[model samples]
Every structure is written in structure tokens, then in C-alpha cells.
Target: MTAVTKRFGQFTAVDNLSLDVPEGQIIGFLGPNGAGKSTSLRMGLGIMEPDSGSVELFGRAPNVQSLRRVGFLPEERGLYKKMTARDTISHFARLKGLSASDARARADELLEATELGEFSRSRISKLSKGMAQKVQILSTLAHRPDFLILDEPFSGLDPVNQQALENLIRAEHDRGATILFSTHVMEHAERLCDRIVMMARGRKVLDGTLKEAFASLGQGARISVEHGFDLAAALSPKGFEAIRTADVGHGETWRIELPPGREAQDALRAALEAGAPITGFAPEEARLRDVFVSLVGEADAAALEASLAEDGVA
Candidate 1:
């Protein structure tokens, strides 16, 4: 998509958003709810027309031939209630242009791969919510498309099922399928994505490799010293800004904010040379949540945390 925009009445859901998904890469589309991720994805797949700009799939407008090479799992999931799991997968695969025999074989393969083999003959209404969702996901990929687009694929799954889906995504990538998945949860993106694109309030906020995102925040560390010791005051003279964060059992923990181009070791060296009785020390690592907070401020980050809490993903 290039500068694609979409609107719902007075609300502009996606605004001048341009995104590129390179082949053979697993890209994570990350943002809290109402961040325009779903709208952008819909536009990309030509499910909804953009108000401005343009969208191209497989180098042209989405059509029958191009769409057949792509697999999409929408945020809203549904399966045929009376159909067996195996039949459901086979049905979708056949729609994607697979022969009847090949579709049934693919269904069996996917059922066993996801450990849903025993449930393959069971009706969708007889399966649990998670199992049904998994069946829908498998249906999307049963035809082995060259590209996969998944919107909030992990939203309704438990931890174990989430892990299984992650592994399934990796396997698809290993099979040479390009994948792009959207999620509000940071941990999944942190573990699985090669690059991340973040959105907030219908605008793209950040887009880059994980290392580049971390480097944008510079460096910092956590330091602990003897109780009642003023580490902040002691480190101030050496050009390091330290804030008292918490009091441990026998010490006070301080967060040292290093200036740009400074290293964490410099802070440790300065503290040791200043005769501070240190008890614990650890370099602060940048998290995706921290990056989001830095980009959109605390309020939006808190909203994201609330979304995660509602979904039971800490």
C-alpha cells in the first residue's frame, strides 16, 4: 500500500499510510486497539477501497488470480457450525483452487501438524472456541499460498495455543511464505518478528528493525546501593542522572539515565570510583512497551496495557 487512506463517516480510520511487506520476511503490525491496523490491512487486501492513494497486491490490483496466491485470516473469525473440522479445511482449500483429493490430504496434514487430528472428524459446534479458531487459521493456509496476512491472530488464544500458533507461523515462513501479522501484544512481536511497524491514532509512529528501535532510546541501567545511600546525588557530579525508583530489602534501587553516546559501563565505573557501596547492578534493556511509551506517551501506552490485561496477556 502507498499512502492509503480510509474513513468511516467523520472518522479517518487510516490516514496516508504507506507500508511495504518484503518477500520472505515476517513483519509484525503492532498497535493498541483502534490504531487503524485492521483498516489498513483490509485496504491492502482490497476488501475495502481506500479513500485516497493506492493498494497493490502481487504487483497489481487484487483479482482472482492474485488473491489465489494469498491467504488471509481476518480478525473476525467464523466457521461452518455443522461441518466437520476436516471438511471445513478442505472446503476452503478447494475454494483456493486445490483439487478435491489434494485439499483433503492438506487438511489431514494440517490437522496432525496442529495436534487437532483426533478432532478432525468432529463438528465445529462440538469443538472448543480455541479449537474452532485454530481450524479457521488452518483453513486459511491449507492451500499453501505464497503470502499470508493475519490480523490479530493471537487475540483469543491461551498461552499454549499462542505458542503453537507462533511455531506454525515460523513453519510457514520456513516453507517460503511471506507473513505479516498484527497484534497489540508486544511479547509476540518481540519474539517472532523480523521487523516491526507501529501505529497510533491512525498514523504510523515507528517502522524499523528491533535493533534500530532500541537504539533510538539510547542506553540506561538499574543500580542498587546500601540503604539510605544517595546514589543520585553521588552520580550527579559525574554527569549521570539517577532517580530513586524503589527500596529493596537491604538497599535502594536507582535508575541511571545515561546521556546520548555514553555507555552503561561508564556509569558503573563512575559509581565504583565514587566509593558507593553497591549491592546490585543491571543494564536496562529497551522493551517494545517502552518504545511505544516514548513514541505515543504514557496515556496511549496505558490503554495498550489495558487491552493486554483484558486479553490475559501480561
Candidate 2:
């Protein structure tokens, strides 16, 4: 989509956002809640129309022909409580143009891959939350679409299930499918994305490869020390702001903020001079959460998270 804009009354939900999903690449659409990630995705998938600009899928405007080759998992989780897991998946596959036999076979294969084969005959209402999530994801992939768009695929999942989902995404990517997913959790994107597109307040704030994004943030390091360490005293005199600090058993760890052109080791040397008994020290790569704070401001980032928790919009 290029220069796509969506509005609700006087509020601009998505402000002239432009994005491209390259074939066979896993792109992480990252942002806090209400940052327009969902809105941008809806426009691209033809679920909602943009008041202006254009959206294209596979070289032309998004339409039925293009949609057949696409698989989508929306943010909200929903499945028919009366339907069996296998039947639910097969139903969606049939909608995507699969024959009865093919859909059933594909659904079985997917259920097995996700380790939910035992629940294949279980009604949706009888499954646990994680089990239901896996089933929903299987339903999305039953047709084997060439392109996949997942909005917050990890939300509400336990660690084990989240890891399982990540493996599934990796397998799909290895099959040469193009994947685009959105998420508030930084760890997922940090591990899976080949490229990242960051949004804030309905605008694209950053877009690049992981390495490029880190390099652009200058330099920094996470510092940990043994007991009797004073992180604030060590860096404050040198004009370095410890962006974050945490007490760790009789000691403290600091996330030092580095000015442009400064190396992470510089902070180490400063710690040494300050007589801190260093337990661990290394260069810190900028995390996506840090990038969010830098781009969107601390207050807004915190507010977004709070809203997500209270409203359950993950």
C-alpha cells in the first residue's frame, strides 16, 4: 500500500502510511496498541477500504483473486464453540477453495504439526486457551496460502505455546511463503523478523533491517555488578544517564545510555574507574522496546501498554 490513509470522523487512525511486504520475507509490523498497525494491515488485506491512496497485492489492486492466495489471522480470537477443531479448520479451508478431502487432509496435517492432534475431535469450547489458539492458527493455514498476515499471533499464549507458534512461523517461511506479522512484544520481532516496520501515532517512525536499526541508535551496554556497586554514582559524573536500573540480589544492573560516537566499552572503563565490582559486562544491542521509547516517548509507550492490559486488545 502507498500513501494509504484511513479516518474515523475527525480522528486519523492511519495517516498516509505506506508499506511493502517482500516475497518470502518475514516482516514484523511493530508498534504499541492504537498505533495504527491494525489499521494499516486491514487496508492492505482489503478488509477495510482507505479513503484515499491505493493498496496492491501481487501487482494489482487487492481483490478476490489476490485474497485466495493470502491467509489472515486477525487479532481477535473467535471460533464456533459447537464445531470440532478439525471441522473448523476444514471449513475455513473450504472457503479458501479447497475440496472436502483436501481440506480434511490439510487440517489433519496442521493439527499434528501443532501438537494438537489429540484435540482434533474436541469441540472448540472444550479446548484450553492455548489449544484453542493453536487450532485458530491451524485454521488460517489449512489452505496453504502463499502469503500470511498474522496480527499479534503471540498474544495470550503461554511460553511453550508461543515457542510452538514461532516454530510454525519458521516452518512456513522455509516453505517459501511470505509472512507479515504485527506484535507489541519486542522479543518475537527481535528473534523472527528479517526486517521491521515501526509505527507510532498512526505514522511510520522506523523501517530497516535489525542491524541497521541498532547501528542507527549509536552505542550502549547493559552493565551488571556485584554487591556494593553504585550505578548512578558511576555514570552520573560522566554525564551518562542510566536509562534503566534494576536491583539484583545485593547488586544492581544498569542500562547505560550512550551518546553518539561513544563505544560501549567506554561505559565499562567508567565503571572500573568508579570502583564497581563488575560481575558481567558486554555491549548491548538496542532492543525494540528501547526503540519504541526513543521514537514514541516514554509516557505514550507506558500509556499504550496500560490501555492494552485494561482493554485486553492484545
Candidate 3:
């Protein structure tokens, strides 16, 4: 999509967003709920028309021939409740242009690989929510399309299933399939994506590799000291910038921003030399959530945190 925009009545859901999914790369579309991620994705697939700008799929307009090479799993999931799991997968594969025999074979292969072989003959309504979700995912890839687009694919799954899906994505990539998956969960993106695109309130905020994202925020360390101790005041004269972050039961934690030439060891040395009663310390690892916070500020960061908690991640 190039400078695509979408509006819903008086509201603009996606504003001048441009994105690229390079072949053979795993791209993560990241943002909290209501961040325009779903809208942007719908526009990309030509499911919804953009109010402005343009979209191209497979180097051409999103036509039938080009769409045949793609597989998509929408955020809202539904399966034919009366259909057997195996039949469901085979049906979708057939829709994607596979022969009946090949589709059935692909369904069996996917069922066994996902440990759902015993449930192959079971109807969708007879399966658990998670099991039905797995069936839908398998249906998305049963035809072995060249490109895959999954939106918020991990929301209903437990930790084990989420990890399994990540492995599945990796395996598909190794098979020469390009993937674009959207998620509010930062950890998933951090683990799987070659590059990330973040959105906030309908606008694209950041687009880059993990290294570039972290480098933008520089480096830092977290130090915990006795509750009454003033680590920030003590480190101030030493030219270190420290801010109190949280309160542990026996101590308080302060985040120290390291200067360009400074290191976490230097911060530790400075605290010790200042006669500070330290209880705990560690180099602060940069997280995708932190990058989002830095770009969109505290209010939106709170929303991101809420979204994570809703997904049982926080």
C-alpha cells in the first residue's frame, strides 16, 4: 500500500499509511487496539477500498490471479460448525484452487502436524475454542500460498499454542512463503519479525528493524535501592539522569539513562561510589513496548499496556 487512507464517517481509521512486505521476509504489523492496524490490512487486501492513495498486490492491482497466491486469516474467526475439521480444511484449500484429492491430503498432513489428527472427523462445534482456531489457521495455509497475511492470530491461544504458531510461521517462511502477521503482543513481533511497523491513532509511527528501534532510544539500566534513599539526587552531580520508576516492597527502582559513551557498569560504579545502599540492579533491555511508549507518549502507552493485559500478556 502507498499512502493509503480510509475513513469511517467522520473518523479516519487509516491516515496516509504506506507499507511494504518484502518477499521471503516476516513483517509484523504492531499496535494496540483501535490503532488502525485492521483497517490498514483490509485496505491492503482490497477487502475495503481506501479513501485516498493506492494499493498493489503482487506488483499489480489486487485481481483474482494475484489473490490466488495469497492466504489470509481475518481477526474475526468463523468456521462451518457442522463441517468436520478435515472437511473444513479441504474446503478452503479447494477454494484456493487445489484439486479435491490434493486438498484432502493437505488437510490430513496439517491435522497430524498440529496434533489434531484424532479430531479430524469431529465437527467444528464439537471441538474446543482453541482447537477450532487451529483448524481455521490450518485452513488458511492448506493451499500453500506464496504469501500469508494473519491478523491478530495469537489472541485466543494459550502460551503453548502461541509458541507452536510461531514455529509454524517459521517453518512456512523456510518453505519460501512471505508472511505478514499483526499483533498487539510485542513479544511475538520481537521473536518472529525481520522488521516491524507500528501505528498509533491511525498514523504510522515507526518502521524499522529491531536494532534500529532500540538504537533510537539509546541504552539504560535499572537500579533498586532502599526505599528512603535518593539515587537520582546522588547520581545527578555525576552527570547521570535517573528517574524513579517503581516501588518494590523493600526498595524503590530507578531507571538511569546512560550517556552515549557510558555503560551500565559505569552507572553501578557511580552508585556504589556515592554511598548508595543498592538492593538490585540490571541493564535495562529495550522492549518494543518501550519503543511504542517513546514514540506516542504516556497516554497511548497506557492503552498499549491495557491491551497487553487484556490479551493476558501483562
Candidate 4:
């Protein structure tokens, strides 16, 4: 996408967003609700047109012809309630130009692979939310499109199913498919993404490889102690910001920002000199959530974290 923008009435749903999805890489499109993730994806797939700028799929603008090589799963869940799982998947495969027998065979294979074999004959209404989601995903992959665009594929799944989806995504990547998945859950992106593009308030906030994004947060260290100490007198005087202090089990933990000249050992040495009962000490690797909070602010990050917690999508 190059300077693609979208609007609904007076509200700009997507700001001037330009994104490049490298071939064969698993890219994470990340942001909170109303951050324009879905809108940007829709524009990329040509399901919705941008008010300005251009979107290229494969090489040309996305259309029926170009989209034949793409697979998409929208965030919204919808299936024919009266249709059996296998038939629902086969139907979509046929629509994508597969023969009837080929579609049915592919559906059967995918159903078994995703652990939905026993429910192949079950109607959509009879399956659990996770099972139904599996069916929808199978339908999307039945034709084995070269590119995949998944919007919140991990939503509503328990930990086990979410792991299963992660494995499936890896399998697809191994098969040479270019995948872009959108999510508010930071952990998923941290584990599965080769690179990430983050958005906030309808505009692109950050985009880089996982290592590059981590490096952008600078350096830091954490120390977990069994007793209290005067952090202000020790580190604050040395130009370190005490990022957080938390109670853990029978002890407490402190995360301190390290200045450019300092390191983790330097922080540990300072804590030891202060006579704190240190239990654990280590360098603080940058987390996706930390990067997100820094770029988007704490309020939006907290709101998104709360939304994920409510959905049990940790």
C-alpha cells in the first residue's frame, strides 16, 4: 500500500498509511480496536477501495483476477448454520475454482489436520466456537492460496487452540505462503512475526523487524529482591528511571531503565551495594507490549490489554 487512506463520513478510518509486505514473511499487523487494522486489510484485499493512493496485490491492483491467488479470513465469523462443516469448506473451495471431488478431498484432509475430523458431519450450530472457527479457516485454505490475510485469527480460541493455529500458520509459511495476520495480542506477534507494522489512531506508528523494534526501545534491566531498598537514592541519582516495582510471591521486583553507558551488571552491582536482599537480576529484553505502550501511550495500551483479558486471549 502507498499512501492509502479510507474514510467513513467525516471520520477517517485509515490515515495516509503506506505499508510494504515483503514476500514469504509472516508480518504482524498490530493495533487496538479502532486503530484501522481491519480497514487497512480490507483496502489491501480490494474488498474496500481507498479514498486516495494505491494498493497492489501480487503486482497489480487487487481484483477478482488478482485475488484468485489470495486467501482471506475476516475478523467477523459467519458460516451457514444449516450446512455441515465439511460441506461448508468444500463449497468455498469449489467457488475458488476447484472441482467438486477435489474440493471435498481437500476439505476432508484439512478437517482431520485441524482436529475437526469427528465434527465433519456436524452442523455449524452444533459445534463449539473454536470448532466453528476451525471450519472457517479450513474453508479459507482449501484452495491453498499463495497469500493469506487473517484478521484476528486467534480471537475466541483457548490456549490449546491458539497454539494449534500458530503451528498451522508456521506450516503455511513453510509451504511458501506470504502471511499477514492482525491482532491486539502482543504475545502472538512476538512469537510468530518476522516483522511487524503497528498502528494507532488510524496511522502507522511503528514498522520494523522484531530485533529492530526491540532495539528501538533502548536498553534496560530488572532486579527482583527479597527486601526493600531506596531505589531513588541508588539508581535515580545515577540518572536511571525506576520503571516499575511489583510484588511477586514473597518478594518484590524492580525494572530500571539503563542509561546508554550502563548495563545489567551495573544495575545489579548498584543494588548489591545498596544492601538490598536481591533474589534475581537480569537484563530486560524489550517486549512487544513495552514497545507498543511506548509508541501508543499507556492509556491505549491499557485499554487494549483489558479488552484482550476480557476475551481470555492472553
lDDT of 1 by residue, 94-210 (tens): 999999999999999999989999999999999999999999999999999999999999999988999999999999999999999999998888999899999988999999988
Cα deviation of 113, candidate 1, in Å:
1.2
Ranking by lDDT: 3, 1, 4, 2
- For each candidate, the alpha-carbon lDDT, in order, equals 0.92, 0.86, 0.93, 0.87
Worst 10 residues of 2 by lDDT: 305-314
Which of the numbered candidates is closest to the native, going by highest TM-score? 1
Residue 157 in candidate 2, Cα distance off native in Å:
0.8
Give me the candidate number with maximum lDDT.
3
lDDT of 3 by residue, 1-314 (tens): 99998999999999999998899999999999989998998888899999999999999879888888999999999999999999999999999999999999999999999999999999999999999999999999999999999999999899989999999999999999999999999889999999999999899999998877776676899999999999999999998999999999899999999886677889999999999999999997888988898899787888888888888886
Model 4 TM-score, all chains together: 0.84
Query: What TM-score does model 3 achieve against the real structure?
Result: 0.84
Please say which candidate is ahead in lDDT: 2 or 4: 4
What are the runs in model 2 whose C-alpha is more than 4 Å off?
Answer: 221-281, 307-314
lDDT of 2 by residue, 161-200 (tens): 8898999999999998999999888778999999999888
- Please list all clashing residue pairs in model 2, or write none if there are none: none
Steric clash pairs (candidate 4): none
What's the residue-level lDDT of 296 in candidate 4?
77
- Candidate 3, after superposition: displacement of residue 108 in Å? 0.3
